[model samples]
Target: MPNKHLFFLLLLTAMALALPSYYFDSNSIRFIFFIGVVAIWRYLWALQHFIRALFFLKVKFKRLRQQEQAIGEIADPKHIFILVTSFRIETDTSILVYKSAIAEAIRLKQPVTIIASIVEPSDERLIKQIFYNSAPPLRVSLKLVRIKGSGKRDGLAVGFRAISNSQVDLESAVVAVVDGDSVLTENCIKNCYRFFSINPKLGALTTNESCELTQSSRTLAIYRRWYNLRFAQRHEFMCSVALSNRVLTLTGRMSMFRGDIVGSSEFIDRIEFDYIDHWRLGRFRFLTGDDKSSWFQILKDGWQMLYVPDVKVLTIEQPPHNNFIKGATLLMVRWFGNMLRANTCARQLPRVVMGSYVWWLLRDQLISIWTSLFGLVLAIMGGLYYGETIFYAFAFWILLTRYLLSALLSTLHGHFSLSWPILLYFSQIYGSMVKIYVLSHMYRQVWTRQKTTLKDSGNRLEHFIRTFGSNIALLGSASIFLTVVAFIAGVLTTYDIQAFISYYFS
Candidate 1:
């Protein structure tokens, strides 16, 4: 079902055309060669994904046929545990999620237990009403776990403990961690269980996600919708990575795990108190990225994780800030910070433990930030001295390539829009800048959705100094660095103001 190879081929073709248009002249040969090297790396990355996606498709089709044959026969049902954690979640979203969970449980024809972890007592009452109101053929048990208005980690810990104490079969039972904002599709439970039944080695699995935007502003709505579409593209890439027994992140939006894995004390401990040894701040606790913590535990335990592309979950997405740009920036800060923190430890793991592809991805994360900025700077300087033709070519290249890629991906995923190509540019340029900033401020963590803030370090003064000081320093350094680079680029490119004036005058 994934068109990863086709997408890559089309992208490569577009880039090939665009690259020559900007770099065909002798004056830009160095720039051309530099970009060519970067393009080769991109090509290899794409090729690797294509190969893995093809392999996954072949295996998935064969497995599906076998599963279809087994579907008619009544298989012994496994105890299904659904943990729904919410902290100030929208009432509508919560109700929808509960209904979907109940519906899916009924479809599976399994003994189901739903654990609802809520910080607000009001949410608990509302969720209970939704659960009781459901009229499923099979009896679905409900467990309500109340928590102080602490954090998602605390909420999850409560649910995890409840599931552990319950009388569920550890070996065969499966635990689905569903975010309160996400509604599971009808086939989600059935499809996930099929994979588990077929592959004993599959430790944990996550499903594909679609987002529902709750914005009234047309501009913000477009941004959110396109942003989610890009997320789907990312999911496809992750699915391909999973063919090699590695997924970059186990998305918390909706992920399924073995009962034993979820019930383990280690998993709960990691979720609640996961931390990294920061050189500057010493040992620091993770305030977010619970998904990453779960992923690290699974990877460390030698469990084979997977991405079930066929399974879909609908997640309700609301912007954290009023301004679209501000909201997007805050989201990226939290996201990239979580990633970089986890990556610190992930890089130290053996290649056999994480797989070679994951290792390369970790390295690529570090390299990509600098490369992106460099490319942007080069284009700007090339335009300033070499004439607007070079810049026009660059802009045309980005627009054409991104539009083609978005169109192709839309055909595959059915979420394409005319605005997606423009959003693609924003994601690359603006998102890359955000990632670079987040990398520097890896110690900071905030739950933008829940309006929760955590200090980067223990001491208030130290946290302030580290957070604000680092930001200011980065700003100053970037300004100076760009200025010098621009000057150098202009000088090296040998621009002639006299020739430009004469030509214009003539």
Candidate 2:
């Protein structure tokens, strides 16, 4: 669901459609023209992200690997105030996240405080237990500031209030918002401080979200594993890389704000309004645009956001087989909402249009969807002309090629297992179908929010079919076109060779 995967899917679709088209009709100038336009636009956007990534990568690469180089390092760990937003911390996952963060805070030996927001109104016992369990000295100082509310925004607002009310000086302390489910690495705090010290322009630093899909023994762990790997390896880190200037959102999962940055009345205004009204009424808002909203605020305030890859955390992914449909559906819905929200923010913040970033984001989304639909139509047309066998064969070839490519990429990246190729294949099939359903579902959700029916738990399969059918059809068309090109090439080679022989003999 990350924009990275969406772009990758778009690129794959574009390649499948455009590459084979060269063989089918060399003289089709319009086709070539369209392909060129898409390719150029994609390259420019990628170039921006790539440049920023390279800069950070080079700095980190030298710092960690090179001993001779006196690269940036945190001499004195800055005074940091940790803000963890949680409804209740009784859950095993929540407890573990707190423990890890506490351990890291202790490791850094910095003054840290935790403010947990009690979101469930009826779960007084749970909240009490959570406070009782997390009480006192793990390493650094800790406080359990409980707020009365039942939503993500409420928790966030509560946390913000606690920080504001606390004696901690907002100007000097590093204010980091760590999600309840995120586990920080040992040196995460150190790396974050280091990033802040080196880049004075950076108002915030976000740790790379190192997520993994885990479950009990046996089942689709392999699939979950690969999915998480793809997500973390690329998407999780992309926001920092891609949105260097015009950051739309700072993720709540593992993002750090300078004490001064969030402590400001301007930045505090973010916690003031949830969506429409103030934070209290819309506290339990179901929308997942919190991160996007933060990014928008930072950009509006003219502060840059930095990403420290070394500051890694293991964010747990929702298991795929158990909750695939619900999970995927939620993902698509959230993404659609995020985009809509981002568009609104972009309009308010016209600086977003000053660069290629917005264009890249919008262009890719529109064209990618178009490519998927176009492929489906072409495949249906090809089938009507050629036959069913040809269509099926094309599908098989497309699947095979995708699996091989993904397998190779995973192997090279060393993030996925040997079995990743097969999982990638299934993901392709399932993801495509899910995408199609998502496209339709997104439209419905956006257009007719009031009359929306409850989604079935097992809707991923249905969504997968809707999404993948178009992809299969497109691949089929590409295959038929490739086949025709192969035939033409063979005939032309034969004719040229015969002509050459006849001329030589004469």
Candidate 3:
């Protein structure tokens, strides 16, 4: 069905169910009212984030247009450094990224230095060939830095050190870090540079990301495509966060920084040896999440970070495993692990330093995992006891609210498809579960890209207890809370808890 038709159908269906009380008794009305309250709370929470996102987006584009109109007034950087890092990268992806970088360089019409950080000599040769074959208009200068196949952090450190040693004018140069699989948009540099020109305090800026799905299976493709769309939605939240002079992560896929900042020894040190002092796991080394380390360093230095929503990078996303569930699980484990590790110390920063809103976001990370599950579990239990009315109402509420949100987001982000509402539910429920597991096993870190595993120190039994204990406690607590709520609801509706329980369970 067409999006327009489907949307209207959803709207009409929602309207049909809007007056459920008219069709049911007073008890049913109360139950529906309770569900409505919860739905409203969730909607308002999402609306707050969305509204801030829309506002920042408006501001970003306005600034972009203004900068474009007065292009001659804005001083373009003297040198633009494109740092490309690769580790056992596919030849096709490496070629695409380098080609895009060269094209972008030509468009910028600046003397561009391309630094290729590679562990495999084969990749270095391939990249060198791409640059060497580039047209004269590109004006591409190539530097190949070889590193041990250690990790992304090490590769980035090597590149940063080389940039520091180069003769580029740091004050007027911009360094962009692009992942091996990421292709830069033509206007990425132009749009990002304007921010640096406008604000000298802007330390770094990350662009919006769109993904190219590489999964062969149709099911996996659908899942990956929707996942990418949701990822775009996340950028909206980041935009709002960036307005407070803090972005949760400066994505390594493609983020630009001032040359001086990237060249500094402090920045290099952070990228090279970023670690968290875990109470249980001792000083755990950061095996991944180079992006988080960079963001933290910038944040710690009081540098302003901004999100360029208009500027986007096309990232090639390959499923880690053939099975969608397995792939998503692996990806989430790595991602949430990275986030949880960084967040441990991030929450310790002074409120003035991190901003109160950011602090709240950090706190929300801990609560939201369980809260997301709470609603679904409530609906399920309500269905079991009270029949399908509660379940149907809950589903209707999710569909109507998420579809409306998807429509609004699609208008802004352009990838919101009919599948988005379904994906939203999956992300909320399954994604929350993944986050909960990762939160418990924060010490687990793995590089899904290169199949590298970093083990947390401890015996299997100790690790199992530490990891699963939190989950058990969380479930037990939620069960007790829900039981109490159910008892109260039973009394309010049926007026006899014992009879209500017997009617359902018996």
Candidate 4:
């Protein structure tokens, strides 16, 4: 089906649905049509991604495997540089991660350098012990660099500099940035290295991720499931975007990059000192999300980013706190904060520069912050005016759609659980709220895993203003969105909003 044909078909279908609502006099019918249309589009979004990702997973991987050189048969494999940042990571997880990386390097039969960036002397010793115990061949070496506990960005900069300065061939070599807690599975590199080998314009690529939770607590268990579901969804989203030769983020967990781009001075500078010029906040320095900087640089320079759905990176899970609600809220604050900050910058790119679909994806992130909560607010308002039956009807509809959505996600990971539906709703509603809160306070940064924050001076008046402004903005936006939702639910009229706006602005 061509895009032109598909677009016309969809437009006609929408027109047909709207005719009934135009004829019907009841708000009940209109609200039903609204909900139905929203659900249809949501499923359509999922359906397209499922098809795109499936094509890549089934078709692309098979074709690449058939055409590309075998793992050990390449004529001249590039020098592999694995940069692992292990700040405050558990010792056991560190050993497992480094040991697996060393094994992969040794297996490659190519010259490899592993740079371990850490602030702890013990971790340095531990990594060294693993290196020596493996007794890697002469082709393998270790470069230990210590940082001042600044952040992952600084650690990565130091490691990247080491690689950039080496005698290796910058054009053909490869760099892998791995978190301390993420372990490489067997053949992870073998599966991904071929993509960069085949595609000359490929600047970087990221692999699928899976979390390994060792704790037995029930709260941690639920969180583990939530993390797994997120990764599953991430796999599909990354694959779909990669079809356009671009990914939103290269992923900080573990992503491979072309050696030349990774070593470039401009690339390093972008990641190390990335900042956004805000109209209100002046210059907002990035406290995290180095991966976004890297992705944006590649996108701007006309390079490709591939998502290797077959290669999986295992991350050792660590809960931010014992209480799930508090931990989840804080984690969302950081995640959405990073997203909104980077997204705001990306949306400013011209359509010609970013492409239409890619730019739409960034713009949709802001629109979704409001639309996600619309149905919920509508349901509550409908119940207040109509009856309990209206709320029950909406509740049933929500549960069905969420469950079906979660079940469809199994196509990515081939696993489904009863908890996914519940978590999906939790994520949608809670995540939207977090995005709203973080939108107004994106300048304030914090790291979830490490207790890190943006360096700032202590000033009571300035801090109070910042806090007050965020609250006012959040409340104002919520009030406006709720008002709109209420109007759609027929609880409020156009005159009501017009009068309020006139009074407020007047």
Candidate 5:
């Protein structure tokens, strides 16, 4: 996702694309050509996003001005609902988050409802204290919805349902969904809410996010880079996707939606109970990634989602673990699990409804898990059988290409990091492995911060069978991949494979 990240991507694409006049047989050329073609196609895909993102920046600025003018002519949504979801959050963080929400509502000077969906009674008391201490207007009232520490999804549903039962007019109201740790910047709510009123079809919109880490023990600094790099990539991708009036996911950190959409019973149900019936996995329920569920439902119902690049949200973060690898792995497992679970979305909905570009984006999620590792496998095999020259060529290509690409990437995010190249490779390679594992064991889900997890409910024997089956699938897939690499690398011939098969059977 980082700019330098594309170095290996494009490098492999060139090797894959320019198959050239290899001395090997047609099969080898065909194999290389096929990989090249996929790489080239994705290379263009990323390139298109880059070009569109640049144009989108200008369009976003112009559109904001136009929207303000439009609002002056017509009335914008006067009623606002702020849904804040928090669980086991620190007291100081609770104060910052609740105060920020109150400030946003007070600025609007409209009849606003602030709902705190929390598990702790102390949080409720803290919020109430903050609310009265600010001396907020009578129009800005507070509501507390207590949950039994179930999860974020349940907390959100309870909050939304409470809003739907209120006296406000759902048709003309706008609802802002914010995580408890996320603090809004000045005019953050005001900037996005006006867009929903002017654009009738705009279902929801999310603001850009920046993060701050509180508890540091040396390893925390790497997470700082990780979060920023991810946020930077998100800013670019969201802007690019928003050009088509679609975003891959509506971030849970801070997003605003048309009240009717968020208030509907169907929408609440999607958040509460989203599941899939995979051919191999059978039927499994989702444990996380409620945002993806929300996005899918909104898009399916023929609504538009947008990204406001200018406005930002400040997210308060803590290190997931003292060991960076353990923390990073846990986070990726959750993220990629959400992605692989959302893979079937393209087929479930009508192609014409979601548009071709959006449909392909969902499909790309499925393909990327494999393609992310394809070149590495080829490079390793080529080194062993073909020659060391092929391996070193790949290594040298990475060094030169990443060093150059990283320089250009800094212009995109307005900052430069000497460590961008190393971070990018770890994200791509490790992220791919995590995706592959999650795809096989789609039933596993975890909330890293809360230490909550959900698995298929079964007895000891059934659980063993499930674990064994997943391991077999994972190892089996790896074996097939290596075999294919052997043939492609010219280490195994057609006769070699046939003779082996015959000998084994005999």
Candidate 6:
């Protein structure tokens, strides 16, 4: 079911029933107690957000239906500026992204401006050729803007500069921003235009990304499936399902921006302008989660964010080349780091404690960190005590539970996929490990003047296995010995408190 809270409810009830035995007999029972507490916290967190998402989803859907009926026509826009931002290594899927956008550009007779910024000082001419030659018709004029830079948001600066320099009338025209790896659905542009046409209050419109799937590319395919199931699926559902009434942030992957909103100083400051004083003592570089940063800025500018899930985009994902281990590491570091940074940002904002939202966000992050830390500890302990047997059991149980929850969530909401179960399991276990790595790296970067380029592959992993393995073994051995002692005491004594021992052994 879409109600993740339901699963938590049943799960929590069982834990509650067994809580007393755990406390009395097992030293390891502390972990179980921690789990129950976290589960309750998570249930409440999901319940509140899911309800809000549902409400907004209903309101937005109804509004869109009314708008579509009123208009009774499609493919209409006076002027549109399609903004595509790029950086670092290129992907083959840019061809598809351009193809999709070009279709929209032709339909609306809007000239498309493709901002192709090369991070490594590569030729913009090659990027220009890719889009220009790929265009279905020669009539549509494509402007290419390339910049030499690194970091996630660096390309955006170049893209923004190009848009401003175009000197287009900001009030009337619409600007569409789509990532190079994302392909827009046939009606995505039309839907965006239609929604904006009907509602004057909407400042930005979002289209959900449908990750491309294929059999040949297992790594990429698995990565794509996992992303859709975990990140995009939940994120879109949050906004489209009406979990949160107000659109928090329009994703940078594929989103439409009104010209006025993009050009306005308020949006520029609030969304686009991430004033990272690199010169400041603690601040390193402007490493950012671009889409969220943009959304926060828009919210600050008093603009309504609309998520049109019907407007779909097929986005290509690049998984690590070194297989599962590399992929897990990358995912954990980026996702956890981003979440932590966002939390830090939220706390720093004025009047953060004044709103229910700030508290919700804070609680969610804290609980996530707590759960991850506890899980890691438990896994290690189990590994040491029961040897690999306990570790595998614990891992399997978590993986299965996470998979079922994610799969059920996916099926209930919409966008069903077979890979949901497998990907869900992998992401759940590996995701946590990766996050630990990222969090640790982030701390190092902040405090130790460590370069972002420092590779985490070798030394970090060795340390984790060496350290965590030892701790798990030691704790597990102690737990096992204690359980045996408790069992013997129960056999000899009439009223021995052996429930906890039995539970552990069983």
For residue 398, what is the lDDT in candidate 4? 67
Superior candidate under TM-score, 3 versus 6: 3
Per-candidate Cα lDDT values, in order, are 0.76, 0.54, 0.79, 0.81, 0.81, 0.57
Instruction: List the candidates' TM-scores in order.
Output: 0.86, 0.66, 0.87, 0.90, 0.91, 0.68
Candidate 3's residue-wise lDDT over 1-506, tens digit each?
A: 58775776767576556746643454566556445455556667678888878777788657655875586635688899999999877888888998998778777777888888999878877877777687645466888999998888899999999999998888899999999999998878877776787777889988888888775774776667667667767777887787676789999989999999999999999999999986654566889999999998888888888887778899988878887778877887888888888888788887887778888888887767766776777677667776766676677667766788887677667665677887777878898878866665566788988898776577898778766776675576656656655663452354565677899999
Off by over 4 Å in 2: 1-56, 59-78, 88-90, 120-139, 212-219, 232-249, 276-286, 320-323, 352-355, 385-413, 417-506
Model 3 residue 327 distance off true place after TM-score fit, in angstroms: 1.7
Q: Summarize candidate 1's per-residue lDDT along 80-109 as a digit string, tens digits.
A: 898999888988788888888877777767
* Clashing pairs in model 3, backbone N/Cα/C closer than 3 A: none
* TM-score, model 1 to reference: 0.86
lDDT of 6 at 232: 42
* Candidate that beats the other on TM-score, 2 or 6, i.e. the better one: 6
The digit string of per-residue lDDT tens for model 4 on 1-506 reads: 24744564465456445443332344667455346555666677778888887887788766766666564346344788889998888888999999998998888767889999898999988989999999999999999999988888898888888888999997878888999889999978766776776778788999889988865666987888899888878988888887777789988788999899989999999888999987756676898888888888887787878887778899987878778888898888888887888878888777777677688889877887877787787778887886665565566566667767776788777887667877989899989988888888878888878889997664888778777877888788888888777777788998887998999997
Cα RMSD for candidates in order: 6.9, 12.3, 4.5, 6.6, 4.5, 9.6
**lDDT of each residue in 1-506, candidate 6, tens digit only:** 44654575466456545443434344664445334454556546555555555556566576776767678655245567777765543545655666677766676555445555455434455556666666545546677665545444656766666666676776766788877677777767766776666767667777666665432455765565566676644563446333232354467778787877777655554444453321112333335556766766655555556777556677666554437566656556655665655555554555432244544565556546545445545556555544554454454446445655554465435665655755665565566655545443442222111113423334776657644654565466445544443333232233344654677786
Candidate 3 positional error at 65, Å: 3.7
